[model samples]
Structures are given as C-alpha cells and as structure tokens.
Target: MGRDLSGTIRSFLIILALSTCCFTTAPPDLQARVEQLEKYYVEIKEHFEAKIIDLETKVVRLEAKVEKQDSLLADLKKGHKPLKENVDINQHCRQNATLRTCHEIHVANPSYPSGMYWIDPDGQGIGDPPIHVYCEMEAEQSDVKGTTSILHDSESQMDIGNCTEPGCYSRPIKYYASDRQIEALIQLSTYCHQNIMYHCRKTPLNFNGIAYAWWNDKDGERHKFSNRSTTCDQLAYTEGYDLQYVVDNVSLPITRIHFSNPFKGFGQHQVSRLRCRGKAKTEAMPRSCEDLWRMGHNLNGIYSVKGAKQMETVFCQFDKRPNEQDFQKRIGYQDIKTRPVYFSGEGRRLFMEKLIPIPFDHDVVNIGGAMDSHSGVFTAPSTGTYFFSFTGLTGFKGGVVITEFTFLSSRGVEEKIMKHSTISFSKLTTFNPITVQSTLRLQAGDKVWINLDFRNDATFRFVDNTIFSGWLLEEEI
Candidate 1:
C-alpha cells in the first residue's frame, strides 16, 4: 500500500511538470526603451504606410484607363466614320465626349443584308448626279476575307444550291458617295439563285413610331408589311412565275414591303418602269454599273371587291421558281396571328355605378376565346401590343348627364384605357355619337371592360351604330 501511494504521488508530480513545460509564461511588459529609437521606428512605419497609399492611388488610375480603352473598343463594333489619311488610326471620333470607333469585322459581317440602305440608281458622274434610292437585301456571309467582285459569286461560300443566274453568293457592295451618303447593295440571291426585282411602293403608315406597308397578296386580301424593324427600303418581294417566263416550281413571293419613315417621293405614286442599279466588279467593269431593266405598275383593270386597287406592276422582277426557303424566312417570318375580337351595341342602356360590359358578340376571329361577346370582357390571348377602337352615338334627350370611362383590369388595379365626356343636351338632345380607339400592351390573362363613370353617377345609351373592335398587333419575342 505504501509503495502504491508513493508511485501515485510521483506520477501526479510528473504530470504537473509536463504541463508547465508545454506552455511558457507570457513575458512581462518592457519598460526599458531608448526614446530616440522609439520615435525613429514610428516614423519609419508611417513612411511605409504612405508608400502603400501612393501605390493604391496609382492602381486606381490604371484601372480607370483600362476601362476607357474597353469602352472605345465597344464603339468600334457599332460603325466608323472617315479619318484623316495621314492621321494615326488611334484617333477616334468623339461626340459629347463619347468615342465612335470604326466598325468591327464581326459586327459588320453578321447583320449583313437585312438593313434598309440608300443607294444611287445611277453611279457617280452619270446622267443624273445621284438620286438616292432606297434599297434592301437579305444579308449572306462567307469567309470572304478579301475584296469581292460584283460580277462574281464566291465558291467558298456555303453550298446553297444551283444558281439560276450569275451573282448567287456575292459579297456586300458598299460605295461612298461622299462620306455622309454611303450606299450598300446586299446580295441575297433567290432560291433559284437569280437576281430579284423589286416593285417598290410608298406606304404612309407612320404613327406612334410604328410604320406599315400594305399590299394585296395572292389571297387578294390586302396584307400589311410584316418586317417591323426596318424603314421602307428596297424589298425583294417579286416572285411566282411571270406570264412572260416559264420555269420549274413556283417561288414564294413577297406580298408587300413597308417603311417606318416617309420619303419625299417614295411609294406615294406608282413609278412605271422604276430604274435600279448594281455595283461594278473589276477595273474592267464600268464605274457606272447601270442596270437596263425598267419595271412599272400594271394596275389598269384588276380591282378589289371594294374597287380599291393601287397602281402596282404586273411582274417587276420575273422569277419562275421562288426561293421559298429564304423568302419564307425573311418575309412573313412572324407567325400569322389573328387574335381578333369585336363588339357592337345596338343602343343598349348603361346603368350608373356599374361595370358596363359591351356584348359585342359578333365573332369575327377569336383565337383564345378571349373576348366574351355576352360578358363584354376581353381576356388577353397573349403578351403583346393590341389595338382597340370604340364608336358610340347617343342623344341627351332624357336630359341626363353622363361620362363614360373605359378601363383595363388586371391583378393590381383597373387602368383607364380611354373615356369620352358629353355634357347634358338640355337645350339640344340628339343622337350624338362618340368614338375612341387605343393601342394597349397587355400581359397574358389580363382583362379589359368598360364602365359608365360610377363616381359621377353617369348613365348613357349607345346607338345601333356603336362598335368596339380590337386586334393583336404584335407579340413580344
């Protein structure tokens, strides 16, 4: 027992010694210091800190310079203007302190032929100075790194098919008539690979930043220009076999082309035998590459049911087999949408302080059953811009005062679409008619209805001639 106790006590003492050895005690605060050295060390620390601050400032300035260079690179992709022949290529055009760089190769080549461009039908130093004619073409691309000849199509381009004529896959031709007015001729060959002729027309559809071009299709119904993003330029819309030419398969034809802006003398009158031009190729090619094909409208006898026919050409650009693959993609590319709803009221009395739903039950073409004719409410069929128009005729013979308000209903609150205010016809009460039309962007499943000014205790009745109609204008991509 004595020996066991002795060993246990010795082990306890050994453990205590090991614990003490593992961790050394913290040192006591030093009081002995040379006042001169202490001050010198502090100054040295401050000097190093100042150097660090200076380095950080330089880094910030360097980063800003890099960002400015990046912005200049981005502008190069948009497009470029002329620079002095002797000036270094680095100098860029500046507007309001913003840089405009030259066009980037990738940006220029991708969106090639689909833009509205101005061209001169007659080359420079020709008969007339330079009549700026609007032209359009579908942009095609090739690995064509060097110059392209107007007379030839590159074999290196992707194999589309057999060329019906020459100039199937050609490079974009751009000529500068002064730096300001440059002309571009895009080569979008037809499916049969023939140069396309265009029957140009002036369309006066400029409203609310939206332009429209209308034409009669083979179906005989006047169709609106389908390409929405471009101003009226040159459209390669002529297709189908010409009574003059015989061929293999019928090619797809463009019904019409529309522009967003109005040109002074374009599309207003039908120009008989309108003249157009193409670019020149080698030095041997004439500088003035004038085309001898004159096209005009042949609209003397053919008429619409309403006897409305514009002066249009018979077949400006003759084609036996149309390139449906291309035309179908460029024109009429958007889904032919017909989410149309129309409502009419036959002198129906409207009650005050109540939602007035016009039972415009005339089913013209309702795709998604959005317009409930009996309920007088139109639920949105899709998310897009829609056009709505309403016309009403009423007389204040009852000496009743009323205000009408139209509202669009959704999850949040009703938004006022449009309203008409007619004073009490106390002295003169006749069947006065009021009409209102509006284009609205609606979300999917949104609802629309009318109300007879509930807050104003208004009441009114619409005449038999009253009408409310709307159609989907466009769908968001």
Candidate 2:
C-alpha cells in the first residue's frame, strides 16, 4: 500500500502527452513539449493528491486491526483458572488409614518450603508432611505486591482455600514448623491431607548404619545416644547372670550400623529379636525405639539395638568361667562371712509380717562382720559368682507365709532380686522352717541385701536355730 506519489504523477503525464500528440495540436520541440506537459501535470496533481489521501485512510484502518489482534493474543496466553482434578484422599497409608508414608522436609530457610502441610491431616498429625503448603510467606513478593487478593499463577498463596497457584522456589516462608517437627518428623502427611494438583519436593535423608542393629526413626532422632543409661524399671531386674551394655545414639555420617553383644543365639529359634527401645532415664519402662522403628536385623543373628540399653545373657549356669578380662577383676569381700551356725526354735518371739532391711546389729550373726547388719546390705568385694542361702523360723501365731527379695545397688541403680518360698505353721508347738537359695554374678561396688516380707497377722522370728549365709563359687563372669 506504499504508493510513490511523484512516480505515479510522472507516468500519467507522459501517457497524456502521447495522446495529445495524436491530436496534432502541441509542438514536438523541447520548449513546446515542456509547456504542454507541465499543464497536464498540474491538472493530474489534484487527482493524485485525492488518491493519496484515500490510501492513507486505508493504512490507518489496517493498523487499528493489528492492534486489536495483539490485545486478543495476550488474553489467550493467560489460559484458564480454577483447575478441577479429582483426587482420592486415601491415596497413601501404612499403619492407619489416615496416616501416609512420607519423608522429612529440609530447606535452606528456617521457614517451611513451598506447598508444605497445605493438605490437612484432619487432626491426625501422625506422619511427615510432604510439602509446606500451610506455611505463611515471610515477605510478600514485591513484584506482585497488593496487585490482587488472589495470588497469580507464579505467586505464593499464604491464605487458605483452593489457591493452587503455581509458584517459584526462590522465596522464604514466614515461620518455622511446629514443635513436633523440631523434635522429629515421622510420616510426612496423611493420605487425605495431600494436595490434589500440587506436588511438593521431599528432602533427602542421609543413609544410616548396617542391618545388625539398624533401627530407623523418621528423623534419625532415636539413633542419638542419650546421657543416662538405664530406666527405673530396668534397675529392678537383678536375676540371671547376664552381661549388659548401653548403646547411645551415634553421631556418624554413614547410615550403616555395626553393633552386637556377646550374647549367643542359634538358628533363630533360641534368639530374641533385638529391637530398638528407649525410655527417659527416670522412667520405669523403656519404649520401643521408634526413632529407628523400621530398622531390623537378620533372623538368627546375635545383635544389639542401637540407641538402647541392653541386658543380654552371655552365659547360663552351666557355661564356662568368664574370659581373661574378667579374671583380672575382683570385688573383694572384706571378711570371710561364711557360716554354719544354727538358731533354736524352742524359744521364739512374736514377729509380725513386714519388710525389714537386714544387718540389724542385734540379728545374731556377726554384728560388725563383713555384712552390715544395720542396713542389711553386703558389698560385693569381688566380681564373682555367689551362692546365697536363707533360712527362717516361724512362731505358732503364723500361717503359711514365705515371700522375700534381694536388692543389689550399683552404678546408682537399685535392683530387686526375686525370691519365693513357702512355710506352714501346722504344729503350733514346733517351729516352721522356710529356706531359699539363689546363685548370681556380682560386680565390684555392687551392694546385695535380703528383704524379709511377712504375710498374714501371724508373727515369725529368726529362731536361735535360724541361719543366713553366702559364699563365692567362682570369680569373673
């Protein structure tokens, strides 16, 4: 449409001059031809000017149409909104229907990552949240600030509702996760709480130890070795000659584990699964090691639980003596408290049922001997196997009553040794006898004692014939 106005005018004038020559009125010479051509050009100029104006008008209309199309294309690029895709709320689960399997989320910012916890757990905060959808934005994206309540496809939606807007991963979140996340994260999210259209990235966890004592806590929290070794209830187990050790959460980078006790097991049948377990040092019972809950061991292997205190039986009564290491250790009993003394049943005093700490200076046996009569406690002079025997006489007022206990105190822990026996006072005139015998291993610094528990209103006393004794059978175990 770009017309050359001057060129068109010259062509028209040349054609008119040729036609005038045919009429034979104008001269063919330079002066005469020029004068005639100039006159014709002046007349055609008016028409050319009018034709140029018409072309210019057409150009303006085309430009307007192009602008309109450019605007329309921009609208098309924005696409549609409020996406609708069906999703199953129960897509993932392991133990419970609502709880979903998930990994812990890690990010550079202290605040949660994009799309974290957006899906609701429906009050079941049992698993790890796959993403940080529910987190707030610490700083508004300055580029889109206050532009609209509905954040754009590339913006962050801090508020609620189906704000499934696409967003970049460049910004920071407003705050930190809840306290539970700070302690440890288990499952990431429940199936029902997952986002329908959004996919959040999961953080990677470092690989841990080997299978021998592999336990897994979602965040590896249980793997940490604690400061205190035993729980309150563990302190009461004073039976069997078992070797024990405490394993704390480790601080190594490798995910593999390498730990085992000397306890022997064979063909899975005689073996016990060494499970990861824990408890507050002050608590009575240890809880399963949930931190490393998923870690497992070989079927019949002798293994130890990581981040747990273990009491394993390395030897039974018939086993050989302790190794050379144990031979060097001794818990010297200060005196030879062995005895074959006897008490008389002929003259017995009334003794009511009650707990009595032994070693009372008046108990008849060596008052100030190696055994402390005041507290009824005896310190293990050496690490050795000991045989303890107890005999008691009953008064006529007594019924059947025989329940006693032994206590061992060591390393700030007090444990109870279980003992049971039966004594009947069928013949009121004759003294009833009760006896209990036990063999155990004692460590140096350990304090052992017997507890006399009386039953019924009937009374009983150590007859002049009664006797209590103990001696080491072997040392080092």
Best of the candidates, TM-score: 1
**TM-scores of the models, in the order given:** 0.27, 0.25
What digit string (tens of lDDT, one per residue) describes model 1 on residues 1-477?
Answer: 446446655755565564445334524222322343345445554555445444544554454345445444554675753222211212221111111101111133333221112222222222223322212222234322212112111111111122222122122212223211111212111111112222232222333444343433223344433343233333333321211111111221222222222433232211011112222222331111111111111112222111012221122121111222211111112654323333333324442234566565355555546677666677776677877766766654444433343556467567676776665634444566677777788887787765444223333444444456677777643
Off-target runs (Cα >4 Å) in candidate 2 are 1-353, 360-369, 396-398, 412-420, 423-430, 460-464
For model 1, the superposed segments whose C-alpha errors exceed 4 Å read 1-332, 338-354, 361-367, 397-405, 425-428, 454-463
Q: Report the C-alpha displacement of residue 225, candidate 2, in angstroms.
A: 40
- Give the whole-model CA lDDT for all candidates, comma-separated: 0.36, 0.35
Q: Write the per-residue lDDT of candidate 2 for residues 1-477, one digit (tens) a residue.
A: 335666776679677868567547645466666686777776676576456545544554454345444444554576733211111222332123332112111121222212212221212343344222222222354221111011112121111112112111111211223323322221211111101011111110111221122222323433422223112113233332221223222321112121222122110101111111111122223122221122211122222222223322221111111121321111223342222112111113334435665443344543214455445566666566777676666554555455465655578677667666555555454466767677778886677665556555445444333355666666553
TM-score of 1: 0.27
Q: Using lDDT as the measure, which candidate wins? A: 1
Cα shift from native, residue 449, model 2 (Å): 2.3
For model 2, what is the alpha-carbon lDDT of residue 216? 24
Clashes of each: 14, 49
